[model samples]
Target: MSVVQAMDLGLTFPAGDGDVVALKDVNLTIGKGEFVSFIGPSGCGKTTFLRAIADLEKPTSGTLSVNGQTPEEARRARAYGYVFQAAALYPWRTIEKNVALPLEIMGYGQAQQHERVRATLELVNLTGFEKKYPWQLSGGMQQRASIARALSFDADLLLMDEPFGALDEIVRDHLNSELLKLWDRTGKTICFVTHSIPEAVYLSTRIVVMSPRPGRVTDVIESTLPRERPLDIRETPEFLEIAARVRDGLRAGHSYEEEHV
Candidate 1:
């Protein structure tokens, strides 16, 4: 099943006395339960594309569908969960309460809310920290809480925008493994945006490379690595090969942009 489909996806914003084109003619299809990543330079519209799929931004001209429905319809039905760069947790709320907030607003019963919150915290390996505040946790733990909150509602699709960008290298590595485990256990479809080529290669089934200044997808590389990815896999020749391919794709996009300019 195609969980996400983007055809001729384009976005433009109004600049001072002119229009800033963010994305143009981007096409992508993400299969159900697949892990996909968008990788590009700093201003390549990776995040913008994510926002469009999440219904946070309306495309200027294009068609985007999630699960055979429009992005707006999917959003209205609460068919997806979004995790931004920051944890975005409310400081006054405990970890469990933070996870439960969505349930509360969505009108889940108290018992079901508790059950889901507990299970999600466990899913993210934050079971014992339910009562702690976000301020009391480390940066990585806070991001996990945010992810837990995203998963607490049991949404089938997750849209993550550089969720681990703030963490240190060790913490990022730990979370990467945990994320793969979670994906294996839950079978949820994930669209992750990141600038790190290695991170994108390690975590994705496919990597979409985009270019800046009217961003467009230049290449989509399918990962050939086995599904049972491990930390040690990063040091293997296969992993390096895929990473090099993605790097080439990124560089190709940049070269094309320079030629056009």
Candidate 2:
């Protein structure tokens, strides 16, 4: 079923001189338990669109519904989990405490909070580091902890914005695999924003490609690869073909901007 839906969604920011159009006429529907990615150039509205869906930003026009309710309703109901580009952990809090913060704020009992934190830490492969500080972990480990914090709340939808962007290539690969396993286990709907074409293709069931300067979706590609995706899939000809298609979509969008100029 459609867990997230955006209809003719548009966003505009108030600049000093004029309004900056970040997104225009974007429409998308994400299914329950689906993994979707938004990819484009730096100035594209990938992150902006994500924020709109998360109720962190309000669109200037159109409608957005999460799980058949408004973004505000979903957000207030804590229907989704959000992982930002940075780890955003509290330095003073231990890893377990950081994960439990949400639960505590949401009024979960101490016992329930402890159970959820432990389960989520294990889910992200950080089971033993519950007592460690955020500074005590590597960049990748810190990101995993951040993800654990997001998952600790057990929200149905996950909105991730470049959560692995700062990690090294090898670390990113490892986390990508771990993320797929987590998705399989949790079955939550994930909306991720990134600039990496291969990363988008590997991690997403659907890719929403957008353009800059008035970030609008130019293409939506549904991946046909198997659910059991492996690192070796990147070397396959089919993978290359899909990557090329994504690149072409971005290029076409850029060319359209140039033509308009």
Candidate 3:
């Protein structure tokens, strides 16, 4: 099943004197169980497109469907889980409690909430730290907890916006590995946005490259590497080839604008 479908999707923001186009002529399809990453420069509509999927932003033109329904309809059905760049955890709540917050709001009973929290925490390898607070955990651990919370409801679609961009290199690498394992085990459709070519190439089944302002997809590169990727894979020739293609796509986008001007 196609989890997300967009056809000539466009979004424009009305500025003081004119309008700013965030996304334009974006046509894409994300299938079930696929890990798709959006990569682009600043002002490119990577996150904007993501937010449109979440119904956080409405498109001004074209058609978009999530699981065969409108984005707002999909959102109302709780069809996806979103993880922001920051952990965004409540320092006052215990790890388990934080994971259960969504369930609680959804009217899940106490027993069911506890069960879901325990299982989700285990999925993120945070089983022993259930009682700890966010500040008590390391940055990486806290992000893991945040992911656990997102997974608590067992949503089939996971939307992550540079969830590891803030972490240190070593921590980001570790979390990236863990995230792939988590995705493999869960088989959730993931739509991630990132600026790092290596990160996009390492994690995605397909990478979407976009232009600058008035963002439009310039290329969609399907990954040739095996799904079971290790950190060492980044150093391989095939990996570097894909990275070079992504870099070239970004440069092409820039050159397109330069030629037009």
From the highest TM-score down, the ranking of the candidates is 2, 1, 3
* CA deviation > 4 Å runs, candidate 1: none
Best by lDDT: 3
lDDT scores in order: 0.93, 0.93, 0.94
Clashing pairs in 2: none
Q: On residues 84-139, what C-alpha lDDT tens digit does candidate 1 reach at each position?
A: 99999999999999999999989999999999999999999998999999999999
Q: Give TM per candidate.
A: 0.98, 0.98, 0.97
Clashes within 3 Å, all models in order: 0, 0, 0
Evaluated at residue 3, the lDDT of candidate 2 is: 94
Tell me which residue pairs clash in candidate 1: none
RMSD of 3: 1.2
State candidate 3's TM-score: 0.97
Tens-digit lDDT track of model 2 for 58-176: 99999999999999999999999999999999999999999999999999998999999999998998988999999999999999999998999899999999999999999999999
Write the residue-wise lDDT of candidate 3 on 4-68 in tens digits. 99999999999998899999999999999999999999889999999999999999999999999
Q: Is candidate 2 or candidate 3 better by lDDT?
A: 3
